[model samples]
Target: MMKIKRKSLFTVFLLSMFILSIVPMSAENVEIYSMEKLLDMYIENSHDIEIMELEYELTELKYQIESDDLDNKERQMTRDKDDFYDTKDNSSSQKNIDEKRDEYYASAKAYAASTKDLMIQEFEIKNQDKYVANDTAKKKNSFKNDLWQLYELDKQLEVLNATSDLYKSKYEVAQLSYSLENMTESDLNQALIDYEQMVLNSDTLINNLDMLKGNVYINLGIEPEGEPQFDIVPPQSISPVNITYNDLLSSHKSNSLDYEKQSYSLEAEKVYFDILAGVFLENSDDYQENLNNYKKVQLDFYNYEKELDQMVLDVYYNYQKTIDDYNYAKDTVELAQRQYNEAETAFEVGQISALDMDGAKLQLLNAELTYDQSLISCAKATDEIALLMDGISIK
Candidate 1:
């Protein structure tokens, strides 16, 4: 028998909040939600978790009915055995008694097999809550990560707005120059196109943010509530990785639900094939189908580890790259800030034009945008790697 390994809860402590009552937010008032608060609301509103709990209850009910039926059958078998023993004692022919005894033994063996199966069912029922918790944890982690992406998108939109404004100013200048016959018509047209494209990009990002928020609201089982504010900020730095890549891959493979599902399917098909072999010839249609299914599942199971290995490698390397990008961005921001400060001083002393100071300020803004974007990436990547490090039970 293959043992089912229990998965560790990703955020067990956070689950304590699930017991607390949720206050409904009014659409009229603005409410600021931290990532943690939003996650609590999402989990509380989740129909998936509720459905899983309901299914577990239904399974328990089914088990009870089956158990009761088995108990009745066992009592009947006991009575039948007693009667058989009595008949054997009074029988004159040994051969007739021996044949009847063989039939009774077969029936008893089948009863025992069913009882063992019920025992396994009882075990599954006992552990079903853990599975539900694991699933909830997975959703919570994934949703929290999504919120960071939305944060990054919001930052990108801010940069796009600034760039659009800059382009708009240039377009206006080009139009003025063209009116004076100093700029070519084609040049003015190019400036207008650039400004329009920037505006379009900004609008697309805004729409994407709204779409994501809509999905979030749907998950929270809430209507749009006056543009709820996001208060969570991504961490700028993460802890260093301690585990080797190979070890990480091993752990991921061991805990992967995909691998588990494939393994179960392979085992089930093998059992089916054995049953078919007993009932039909090897060349029969039913037997051949069963054999094919078993072969397919077997192949899938064999190939699964390599796929998982590659996936883990990508996640590991992505984490390292995000960290490197963030550090470089941070350094660039510092350099830009220093140059902007010098430009400001020069302007104050009438050593440089106001235009030069403005240019320096724009450089700083762009650098900061890059830093913010990389910060979000680093935070998300750190979370992903940490999930593997902590061994979050994914069901």
Candidate 2:
């Protein structure tokens, strides 16, 4: 019996060591950063932002190309006028005729230049407006809001970690109690089991924190080892516009890039339809093939417009849902905290069981989790709104 008891005690010692192994060595040493810093870090590191800037550069190049095309058209008209007069009868080479050709060419060139310049200027202005309207200022405020959420989650995790430590300490105490003949085998067994479970929970929390860090790194385009920092620059405030949602929708109907692209596509399609109706058909099969291609471009334009409308509606609805969820989660956390305080007090006064205390603690933990999730959702919703408004910063 003495040998059997020794073996049992040895087994418990080994189990205790295994449980202790789950305790994170670096938990207390890990650096915690504020949300503003995180956001700044993300932006600095984000590849997606770089890609968007590249796309903007490409669009600028395309505008320049179109401008050049207009210039070339004017140059060709000038050349045509010279050719026409050089071949005309010298007797009829009236200076008035030459003046008329010059005037006509000048007017055509001016009109083309004006239209091209207007388009290019409009595009540049819109690009600048997108950068200006982007809520970089609000981003810091949003980060502040997210910071509160992270703090809450951190606090909850801290509690769980502390609770795990408490369980381990209690298990040690139970072993001592057993040695002193004050604790039964059943009590010791239960304490050991609880300690093991708490260790698992602590490990899970650490894993979750690590995962969050990974996601932040991915979003910011930073390596995992990069030190994250944020600069809090205040945004230049703007006067509030009195435009309603309907007004915005109306303005966007024509001004949105997606809409504009669709309109251009539709116009191209109409040209194709004309070609397909044999309006420009020569005897050549090559010309007929070109006409067919134009028709296909038109069909694609209609499909694109339909897709864009659906996308706009989807984004709007998602933004609304995110706002609602954030409000609900915020309110729920307040209530959960209140309830937890009451339960803790009741438990301390012996008015509630340990199970009831645990339940309250779990409820508060869940609330904190939900609140953090809501903050993320709200940030994403804000991004969506910016995207819809074409107000996303290039880089």
> Model 2 lDDT vs. the true structure?
0.53
Flag regions of model 1 displaced more than 4 Å.
1-34, 58-126, 221-227, 254-265, 277-292, 349-356, 389-395
Candidate 1 TM-score, true structure as reference: 0.69
Top model number, lDDT: 1
TM-score of each: 0.69, 0.49
Model 1 agreement with the true structure over 1-395: per-residue lDDT tens digits: 00111122234332111111123344345444444566787899888898988988987888898888887766755665665677689998888776666555545544554565566556658768656766776787777656666666777777788788778878887888999999999999999999999999999999998788678668877766667544334454445556679887777657654455555555555654564455334686655765787688678777775666666788889978987898899999999999999999999999987556667777888898788778667655656665554444322
Query: Clash pairs of candidate 1?
Result: none
Pairs of residues clashing in candidate 2: 42-220, 45-220, 45-221, 46-220, 269-298
Q: Give the TM-score of candidate 2.
A: 0.49
